[model samples]
Structures are given as structure tokens and as C-alpha cells.
Target: MLRRPQGNLSYVSGVTDDPLRFVTLSQALDETVAAHGTRAAAIFSSEREVMSWKELQRQSDDVAAALLGLGLQRGDRIGMCSANRREWLLAQFGAARIGAVLVNLNPAYRSTELEFALNKVRCRVLILARSTAAGNHLGMLRVLAPELDQPGAKPVLESRRLPHLRHVIVLGEGLVPARAERFSDFLRRGSANGKRRLAALAAALDPDDAVSLQFTGGTTGAPKAVALSHFSIVNNARFAARAMQVGEGDKLCIAGPLHQSLGLVLGVLTCVTTGATMVFPGPDFDPLRTLDAVSRHRCTVLHGGPALFQALLDHPELPEYDTSSLRTGIVAGAPCPADMLERAVQLLCLDELTVVYGMTEAGPVTFQTDVDDPLELRVATVGRVHPNIEVKIVDPDDRIVPVGRLGELCVRGYSVMRGYWEDAKRTRDAFDETGWMRTGDLATLDADGYCRIVGRVRDRVLRGNRLVCPEAVEALIRRHPKVQDAQVFGVPEVKPEGRSDAKPEGNRGEDLCAWIVLAPGAAASAEEIRAFCRAKGEAEQVPGPVRFVAAFPVTASGKAQKFAMRASMVREMKAREIKTA
Candidate 1:
């Protein structure tokens, strides 16, 4: 177990004894290919596409050269809108090789969101898949910028909606837009001269140069562009691999989308840095497919959130697949209830499961459980500070809080992002004078240097002038065997018309509302849930208005949309004339 910190202060800097390779992503790829020439670098199982390290290097260079041939300059932004596929990987590494920032467009984004992202980043080129099961991505693009669909006198697209966007490169077979080029034709356009220029540009690149732009999930508000450098993410991947003890020849199943930090920086980049083989089960995450990939490839590692694990465990055929090859992997991007973690370890044969805690602005991971840590620490806490990173808990006044006290989690380290892209005002608000990035997450540091995230700062509920943390109640609710998931929030007391009363009866200004998802084949009423809470929790911890919900609105990454749920509950209560306690 992680004991008390060596210092007297609340601050902790991860011990930096191990050397980190501070190299660009392109250089890292070259070095990996040099060391592991014929090793399987990437495998897209559904597509039956497998590339050796050498092949990845050559193909990435070809794409890089192609971008240069198309007049894309160094430092230009290129947007990609697609699911997890072989082409996404190619665009990611290829754009990095030429120092052009690859802007990851969420495949779930419609035309409006897509237009905002591209125009916000000033992307000169967009790489897209023609269609997906989710929607027709190309049709959405055409709807957003119709100039692309129209034949111009010179076959050029000039859209007021996307002034900076120049070319649209389609990945799959489809009707080519006037301003779009086919993926294969785009590749074939590269010349020997362009290849030579790509080599020179790679040689001139610096580790600190911003190589990629990942938009924040925008759950709280508008998604801001986060600029990440090669220095930040490359070293982050190195240390993350070290924490997981990933090594050469380890087959890692990547179930998350490649756009997010989890899949791009941690999953793919970590494998590149550690010489591990990356296995993509399919375009989207499927419990059965993930299990099949692990069994078929003997994958030693897997990456996903708690919901994905829950799905795997709930699958009827989970026992059919042999998962003995899964020695370790990450359960991150959302809260991992203790029961879920235990179930994963027991059923999936993952003896070394880690819980990683981070956000996009911090290179995605600043604290993670070590493979050797006790299961209690792994389940109850987010583990200790990461290597080469510094963390401190601070109160609202920005003063450092005492140990074991709840406060805002602050991080300062090599992995800290440069800033919100091109938004100086937002960037200035994100950090303090000392350069500590305020995480906006309420957390507590234990005496043993372990940290536990309680909730978001905005998630605090005000009840009778006292701050109530919904996560505390939610945790208690999740402990119920019949409860599959739970969310607790504060609802403003609504007064009846013509009442003109000081406040509603039994109202302390706010009432606690609970939304729950029952386990499969398990049924629980609101009274039963409240009774269970009363049995397990104190008076303040029990929710006043308990609600049973079949599902929750979530982001693409599976993060529960608490705000959306709150709005939905408010509407339901007003419509049903439900009274709160």
C-alpha cells in the first residue's frame, strides 16, 4: 500500500528515477520499427488488416508525403471523422510524421459540431469515412457545406461555413465530392520529391511542437480544443507502459475509439513506445468481439471503461471465450464500482487490472493504480501520483488543503497540455500563477498518498445551505445488489401556483433526487431503494425522491450525463405533479 508522503506538504511529485524518451511521435515510430521490424504493429480484426512495424512505417510515410503533395504545410490542422479503423491509425501517425496537427473529430458529431470543430481549428484538410452505421458522415458534411457537393468552375470548394477547409479526403468507396479525393488516389498522388520533403520535415520537428488537437468532451459546455505535444504524450505513454509493465510482443486489445486520449495516447502510442502489438476488435466496442479477440490473439492486455467490463461480464457467452491471456489492462474513463472490478478480475482472468484517472487536458493520465498494488487500493482509490507529475489538493481559495481533506485536484507536470487551442482567455482561467492546472474535480488525498475523486466541482448539491455530494449517495446505492447504476442530484423545490408561501412544505430549498438502473431480471421500487439507502446511510445521505430509470444519457465515452438526467427528471416531476419529501 502507498504510505504517507515523504514531505510535510500536501503536494506530491512522482519519483522520476526512470529515464523517459523525449521524442516526437514520428521518431518514436521509426525507433520502434528499427527495434521490432517484422513485429505485428496493428491488427484490425473485423477488416482483416494487419500491418507489421515496417509496413506501418512505410505506409505512414506514404500518407505523410501525400499530405505534403496536396499543399498541406507543417503545423496545419487536418481533421478526421471516422470510427476506429485502419485508416484512422494511418491518418493519426501520418499527420504527426509531417508535423501537421491531426484534429480528431468525434464520429458521433453531426454537421454543426463538425463545422465548428473544423473552423475552430482552421483545418485545411478533412479525412472522413463515407458512411457508418451510426449515420452517413459524408451526407452530413454535404449538408453542412454544400459547396463541396456542387461542381465549381475550377473543381474547388469555398464554403462560408468552413473558410479554412480546402480538401475532403474520403476513406471508403463512395461518390467523390467535387472538392474530395478518393483515399487510394490521395495516396497515389505523392511523389518521390514529396517523400524527400517529408523526411526533411520530420528531421526538423521538435518534441515540444503541438502535434495533435483533441477536443474536450464538452459535457459541461462547449468543447475546447486542447493542444498536446509530442513531448507530453510520448513520455506519458512510456511511463504508462512502465506502470502496466507492457512489453514487446504483448497483444493489446483496443476497444475504445482512437480519437480520445485513452485510445490514441494510452492504447496506441503506449504500444508503439513499448513495442506491443495493438489489436482492434472492430469499428465499435462489442463485448463478444472483444472477448473473441482476446482469446484468438492471446492478447495480454485490454483497455476499456467500467461499462464495457459490465457488458462483458453480463454477456451470456462470457464463459465461452478463454480470457486467460488477459493478464492486465485499464478500466478507466468512468467510475469503476468495487463490485464491477471484482467481477472483472474473477471472470475475465485479469489479475492485474488498473484504474486510471485523468482528463483530456492532462495528457489523459496523471494517476493510475500499479499492477502490484493491493486490490483494495486499486478499487477504492485512483492510486498515487504518476511519475514526473506533481499533484496537490487546494480549497476554493486556492490554498493547499490538509491531507484527507476534500478539495479541487490540481496537477502540474510535463504532461500538462500547453493550453486550450487558440483561446487565451480560457487558457488563462485554466491555470494559476504557478502553472498548476485546476482539474475542476473534487478529490481527497489520503494519508497514504492515494487519492479518491469524489465528484465534479459543479456536481455539488446544495441542500438546506449544506453542500451535498451526490457521488457519496450514489456509491451507497450502487452497493445494492439489485442496482445496476445510480445517480443522485439536487432538485430545486418547486412551489405550487397561488401558494405565495415562503417555501414548499418539507423543502429545505432543495431535495435530493435519485435515478437508478436496475440490474437485469432484478426489480426494485423507489420505496425499497430508499429503505436500502436508509439502512446503509445516514439521514443526510438518503435521497428524498428516488426514481427508477432504465438508462442514462451518456457521452460517446460512456460518461453519465448528470446534467441531462437532471433536466429530464425536472420535466418528469412537473408533468406528473410528483411531490418531494
Candidate 2:
């Protein structure tokens, strides 16, 4: 058991004294594939399908072959959109196996919503799920097909399905009339024996080879694509799994979307490489269904954003479900409440809950408050850096701060992203001259190395339990006919009762609120704005407080002065409460 901080407990035990060679993600997966060829790899849901290690290998290989057949060359971008399904894994591994970069799209992104990402990434092939409990996938794709670049337009594809897009392989129920091939059909048409070829491809990949395009909330309305490679992803996952001690027979219930970092690296792949069973909530992400899945599946570990825990505890049916199987897991994407962590142990029977602090750029970076730590520390802190991670608190001048002094969290380790894809200016700005990746999160490391995230130094918002990608939200708002310019942020947070003080400017804190300027005569109401956000009954980066403006207060660079909007939110919330009262 992790004892109280009487003194610095020696953390030397978890580390190896010998030199260790970092394995790339492809190499890691390849080794696992060779070691556990026929083992049952993944299980989805009842009446749903399962993929054994052997089957997973063959399917991904076939997918790779089909992608190759389309003449998709190395380092080409392949975007995929799907709920938790067998094919999602196939697509991810298939793309990686053939040295193609994988770009994950949120399943909720409609065709109109996907266009920006598709265009931004210069996508070659898109593999998507046909349907889920939420809506029709084929319908969404068909909607996006026509928007593809015209012949001779930029952002080329592999098969040229939509003039600019090369091919579309439907993972589940397929899009007909659009002429996209079924994922299974595409797989079956190819040779399943690409073992030697895939290995050769893996050998060509180095620790720094960029393999994935993960978009994060950039400044204002620009989406920054974080390029992560096999080495960064695999090494980080390896250390994180060790820190969490995830192993066989452990059933991991994931409420986070499989598309995000929490879902992809920490949720899906972490479970897979660790031999843990990953259980995804069916469409709609209802808390009751999550509890039901837990009670029925006897899920031992559950990973969720902070909001899910709120819904789970508030769920009227929560008492009926058996959650005794739960022991340890995480509240990774956002800082959780002290009370919530308290209830997790005494009320919910969680052995422990980890407050993971990291971003898409660098993750599994700092893991705070282990399974055996005191409740207060676990709930309030993001713990310490994982065994392999190196974290330093640096001030604005790039100097290391004293213990407990809040500064930007700088990480130099396996979790650091390679760079922003094809955007050298952004990548250069992301880090200092040194190799350290500036996380832009304001945090303090206590004497014992526990990371306490105070707030963010960026204009983004960490709303509830999810990273409210303000850039994307603002971009969408900007595209509206009536909107001319906008800046978004997380407003006074309703999460974690104690951490209620909202900081509107500079990152590691606050909930989201947006300021918008109407085009000539375009006006909007709260209802219309919210209606625009509601999708499948789940809110994803839903905007709050449509602060209409004649103009956004700007800096010399013409950047929006978010602090002014921050002041507005404080006043608006106060006034709204007073009127309601």
C-alpha cells in the first residue's frame, strides 16, 4: 500500500537499472502479435463481434493490403470514424502496419463537421462505421462525399472516391450508391499474409517517425494537428500500464470516446497490449447502461471523464447495479472533485481512482496518487510523473520553479508528441529550443513530486470532464452565416465543487463560455445555439453564453482578448442567478 508522505519513499523499485531500448508502437504490436497469435484479442458487446489476436492480425493485414492496393503510399493520411467496433481496431492497426498515418475522427462528427478535418489532414482513405445507436454513419459519409475537393484540387486521396478522396471503406453497414466498398469486402479481396512485408515496414519506422495525426484545440479557431509516432505512443502506454498495473483478467470499462487520447492510447490500446478486456458503452453513453454493463460484465477498471462520474452517481438506477467489481481506474481528461474521489472509495467501492494529468501532445506523463495513497491527495492532485516520465515546473522565463511554485508543466519523455503534422511553425512554437514539450498547464510539484494542476495557460477550456476543443467550437461558430468572429473558453466550472473559481484566460483551468460577433445582421438565441450543439442527446463541446459582440477586443496580432469575455461571463452568471433568484 502507498503510505502517507512521511518522507520521500524510494521510487527506485519500479525502474530498471539496465539500459532499455524504446520500442516503436508498430514493433510493440508486432511483438505482441507474434507472441500471442491466437489469443482472444478483443470483445465488443453481446450480439456484437469479437476479434481474436489471430483474427485481428489477419483482418488488419487484409485491411493493410487493401489500402496498399489502393496505391496508398507510406506516410499517407488515412482518417477513420467509428464507434467502438472490431473494425476500428483493424483500421488503426492496418494503417499503422503499412506505415500509413492514422487520423481518428470522432464518430459524432457529421459529414459537414468532418470536412474540415478531412481537408486539413489531406486524407487519402476514410474507413467509417455504417451505423450505431446514435445515427446512420453511411448517411453522414454520403453527406460528406460531395464536399470533397474537385479534380485537381488539393488534399488528394487513394481511390479517388470523392474527386479528392481516394477511397472510402465502410466498416459496418456500408454506404451504397456512393460506390464505397465494404470493409469486409475490401479485406477479403486482399492477401491476408503480409507478415514479412509488415515487418519490413515496421523496421523502417524509427522512434521519431510521425505515425498519427491527432488534432488538439489550437489558438482561436485553428485546429493543431499533433503528430505522434510509434515510439512516443508505445513507450508512454508501457509506462502508464505499469503505473496502473493493468494486466490480464482485468476488464476495463471505458466511457471516454475511443477516438480521443484517453480512449485511444490510455483506453483502447493500453488495454489491448496489456491483455485486458476493454468494454465500451453502447451508443448514447447513458450512465445506467454503463453501470449495467459494469454489473453484468463485472468490469474491474473504469476510465471516464469527470462528467461521467457525476452522471453515474446522480443516476437514479445507480443503486440497482452491482459495481463491486470496480477497484482502480482513472479520471484522466479533467481534474476531479475531492468529494467525488471520496465517494468513489467509500460509496462506490473503487479501490482507488487515479487523477491522470497529460495531453494529446504528451501523455501518461504524470500519474499522481497511486492506488494506496490517501484520499485527499488522490482527489486533489494529478500525482507524480510515471516511472519513466520526467516533469519539471517551469516559469514563464523557462526556468524551473521551486517545489509548490506553480508554473507551466514541461515534460521530456516518451509521452511527448513528435510534432504538429506538416506545420513546422506550430510545432516550433509548441516546444522551447530544448526538447521539453511545454504542456501549457499551470501546475506545481510538491516535494514528493505530486503534480497539482492549478489551471491552463491557453485559451482553451477544460469543461466538466472533457477538453472542450474551443478551436473547433469557434470554427464551427465562425462558419455560421451570421457569425463573423468568435473566441471560446470554459466558464465558471460547475465541476469539482472546491475548484469553482474560473480563470478565463491562460490554461489549466475553467469551464467554457464563448464570445461571438454577428455577421452584418445575423443574430442568434441561446436555444438556437444549444440546438446546434445537441447531437444524439450527448453534448460534445457545447457552447455556453453566446456573448454577442460588436467586435472582439484584440491584441497587436489581432488575437481575441479572451479576458474581456471572461469578465463578461462572471457578470452574466451573477446577473442570471440574481434574476432567477
TM accuracy, model 1: 0.93
Each prediction's Cα RMSD? Answer: 3.0, 11.2
Error of 1 at 426 (Å): 1.5
Provide the lowest-lDDT 10-residue window in model 1: 1-10
lDDT of 1 at 159: 88
Question: TM-score for model 2?
Answer: 0.74
Tens digits of per-residue lDDT, candidate 1, 296-396, equal: 88999988888788899989999899999898988888778888899888999889989989989999898899998989999889988888888998888
Q: Write the per-residue lDDT of candidate 2 for residues 463-559, one digit (tens) a residue.
A: 5565555755765666566666677776764322234454433443455576877778677875566566564123755775666778876532233
lDDT of each: 0.86, 0.68
Scanning candidate 2 in windows of ten residues, the lowest lDDT window is 5-14
Error of 1 at 360 (Å): 0.6
Candidate 2 Cα outliers beyond 4 Å, as residue runs: 1-21, 34-38, 110-112, 131-137, 147-164, 192-196, 458-581
